[model samples]
Target chain A: MKLQRELQIVNRLGLHARACAKLVKTANQFESDIVLRQNEHQADAKSIMGLMMLAATQGTRLTVITSGADAEDAMTQVQHLINNRFEEDE
Target chain B: MLSLSGTGIGRGIAIGRAIVLDQGHNDIPCYRISATALSGEIERFNHAVDAVRADLKRVQRNLPTDAPPETSAFIDVHLLMLDDPVISQQPVQTIQEQQQNAEWALKSHADTLIDFFEDIADPYLRSKKNDVAQVVGRIMGELAHSPGKQPSDLATLGSSLAEQIIVARDLTPADTIMLRGRNMAAFVTSLGGPISHTAILARSLGLPAIVGLHDVIDTIHNNDLLIVDAATGTVLVAPDEPLLAQFRELQQQHLRHQQRLTLLKSEKAVTQDGEAITLLANIELPEDIEGLRSAGAAGVGLYRTEFLFMNRPKPPSEDEQYQAYCHVLRRVEGPVTIRTLDLGADKQVDGGRPDRETTATSALGLRAIRLCLSEPSLFKPQLRAILRAAVHGDAQIMIPMLSSLRELEQSLALVGEVCAELEREAVAFNPKVPLGGMIEVPAAAVSADLFARKLDFLSIGTNDLIQYTLAIDRVDDSVNYLYDPLHPSVLRLIRTVIRAGHEADIPVSMCGEMAGDPAFTRLLLGLGLRHFSMEPSQLLEIRQQVRQSTLAGLSGQVTDILNCVETGSLYDLVDQLNQTDSD
Candidate 1:
């Protein structure tokens, strides 16, 4: 199932590289397979290298997908992560 | 002579030779399996791995115990990379397939990997390219037949061309260490910042370094003589006689001034009229304690606890926090005022949520005391550790972002709870440790009299107060022009806080960015503030400023300035004082 959510880029200098990799890493922790697509570019949520390639700017919109037994919960938790810019600002 | 310009991160000068490092090839073949050569290739790869591991251990053993733990952890990662079968096995397989030497195969594979990272647009991600390059460089060196010897060309120019080294790009800390024994005068890189490891190391070693000097490599030719003025961030090429003579004089003057500062470090920080003032040091790291002792700081006024939590993956354990606090207390003979964790939405811990609710206008939101109250689990351990460490010396606990009396009451209750727990556990601790609050918010400053009555002491944090009073984000470069510490409103707030604290007969001190600045030293002193906590670097300079003025004159002039509607330059005020001193 695909989940769409709006998250503000709260960290200084926007949602650049390292923060995106962190988001992807968190998403991969669940049993569910995850994918994050931003501005029409999709990447495997398990690879730090792949998520870094997205170059998600601060305040940019993103779409996330999760598939597995706990996909619903994973999507709900991951939504909080994306909306919080992976919590890098805090 | 070749010259390059860059941002000056550290202040100092050096003259040495240039040693240019080539970006070695990156692609290593995955499999090297000629049936005849397979056995030999495998043997060679194993030996290379063992050699890299030994080299890492040697570096780790030589590192100072007091050095940042990150330095040792970096070496550990390298060791793990060497042991990774995926990395080691692929190169041997490549060598067998291509029928090439193991060294050549590894270099090719590493080059390919580096090029892939170089194509990325993000600068932070791009910075990782250097880390990758370092791993490959070490592996390739290990596989090479002549492991320690420099290439023939570099060997020829070794000690003879000792001048300034201008790199085409940023150099890693490993690269800086390689040039240790050489007479390398200065470093000019195409890119970096004041906070980069290269800059920090250069400052620590007292090397003249300039970063972000674009096109420096192409502009300067080999064997060009250059003069690097680290203070002003200037590089002079082929200078005339007069210019060289001027620099020589300036250099001598700087050295003499430094010596004079050293002599004053032990003297009392008293005004001309014999009024004494307390001078303390504000530090971020444990290593900075040495600087405080050297600068003759009476005590540490503000020990920023945020740094302990900032870079780590999670909050430091209670034992870890206790050890660090105890170490500082034992080292410094004077009072150590430790501010409990001031983290809010702006600073996120590992696995923590980003403070999305905080806005440009939300200076008071989810920060300091507010964050601590909401996150008691995170705040309690630190409080317990600070309270436990107080038994070692004069340790005082300061709570950040206290806007109301109720917040103080609740915070005090938590402290009492921790004290009760310690008593039950039979832990030895100080029962009479003083408690204080930071007056950084305008609301806190406005009601300082009420706050002073409740707390034992008050430290004015001018940085946040100025930011909130003027409604400007100091970090935002676009709006930084408005981040003034000398604004009329800011001065008034400082005055109000000082008056409130003094009226209550409680000790008051200023321990923020404004305290470190020389320009504001007199203004703060004139406002009846006798205690200052600032960076170790500024102690002597501020001490000198303190000794030149009488309290009466400072107070009178400050009163006149406050009454005037027209604003005047802060520099003009300092200059007027200087003129009077000379007359």
Candidate 2:
């Protein structure tokens, strides 16, 4: 079973390199095939290189799709991270 | 002679022989290898990778745990990528299939990755090229069995180039970090910007460097006599003896000036008319006290307590703070003004990882007293510690960035409350510990009299005062040129603040970089500033300047110079004053 949720970026600095590292770290916590997408660009949430290609900016919405036994858990954590704005820019 | 212009790192100069460092990896030779040597080549590659990994791990271990996590993350990402099929496994497969040498195989994979990163749309991601290049450089370095140049060639010239200047096309941050321990005279690169990582590291290491000189590597050769005048961004190559001799004289004068300063370490910072000015030292770390004592300091004027709050998991407990304060108070017989935890933006207390690059607005952000006052829990523990330390000796409490009378009143009231708490706990402490505020902000300087009337003493923190007054970011290299202490407005403000303190019957002291500089010692004296606290390294030089100056009519001359300022021409007066004194 695959679970997916779309959320809008809220941090002041957006999905820059630091935020990408943070996203990658959180996504790797679960045993799920995670993919993040913005417009036509899609990246493996586990890869720093893949996420860098997404180039998601503030106000841009990203879809988080995970397919594995822990898909729901990965979705919850990544959504929580996105909602909190990466703890950047107050 | 050849001339080149570039972005200068700092205002420093160096004259030395040139040593070209061809750190660029584009020139590495690549060739097909025999099947018999394939496994040996692969083995060599693995050994090199392990060595580089060990080096990177050591760097990670050396970094302070509390350092901004990104710093460690930077190396960690590279380490992780090293295990990736793209970096670690791809090149090995390429070596077996293509019959290519290990160096060439690695380069082939790196080139493909570099092209991919370059094609990334975001400029931020595009900068990842440097990281890839650095990682590849290390691997190449391993294959070549040397870091900067081929080892076989370096064996002869390395010793000869020990006292040489490095001229390179460009330098990555990792390359500089790797070579930071080398005692090179200076660095002249063909590329950099003022606030770039390269420039920041150069400034921190106090290395004279100039960058962005197009074709610098092309124009200069090995062993060429190069004059790196970083102050002016001018590189003189094989200059005539007359010019070389002039620079040599200046260098000797610089050395002699240092000798003269050391001689003044034991002398009194007294005026010709016999007025004994109290010259103190500003200390940060506990070890600074040793130098302070050796320099014959009268006392510690500003004991910044920020060190206790930095690079830690949480804020120091009151007892921990008290112990550190007691250590300093025990060493100094003279009074030590313990400035409370100047926290908030620049200095983190909430365990936030330190950022590699300081944001432009951190100076104006909630930092120093602003951070402490807003977070009373942070402020109270430090206040309690300082109060407790007072029982050991003459320890005074000082508040930083007190912009308004209300802030000062609130801080003092808090101090009073802490003292009462100590009393209630039956703790022995100096209840009447002297309280003062740092007059750093322009508003504080303008309202100096109001503060002087209430506080025991006034200390002018000119570093921030100048920046705040001029609205210039001193750390920002572009506008930092305008951070002039001699600006007419700045001089007048210092004069007004000093005058206000005197009228209110308070002793005024200045603790800033300007206070330590020998050039401004006479001007500060002329402005009636009798108290000064500076770095231990500068204490002797300032003392020497103070001893040579006569108070008689000095104020009149300084006043005349202050009036002569016609916007940015204040340096002329400084030159004129120094010229007359030398004559």
Best by TM-score: 2
Model 1 alpha-carbon miss at residue A81, Å: 55
TM-score of each: 0.57, 0.60
Task: State each model's CA lDDT, in order.
Answer: 0.69, 0.75
Residue B73 of model 2 has an lDDT of: 73
- The Cα RMSD of model 2 versus the native structure comes to 16.5
- Which stretches in model 2 have alpha-carbon errors above 4 Å? A1-90, B1-108, B111-256, B348-361, B579-583
Docking class of 1: incorrect
Worst ten in a row by lDDT for model 2 chain B: B147-156
Interface RMSD over true interface Cα atoms for each candidate:
6.0, 2.7
Model 1: per-residue Cα lDDT at residue A43: 68
DockQ of 1: 0.06
lDDT of 2 at A76: 90
* Local lDDT at B162 for model 1: 47
Clashing pairs in 2: B68-B353, B68-B354
Looking at model 1, residue B571 earns an lDDT score of 49
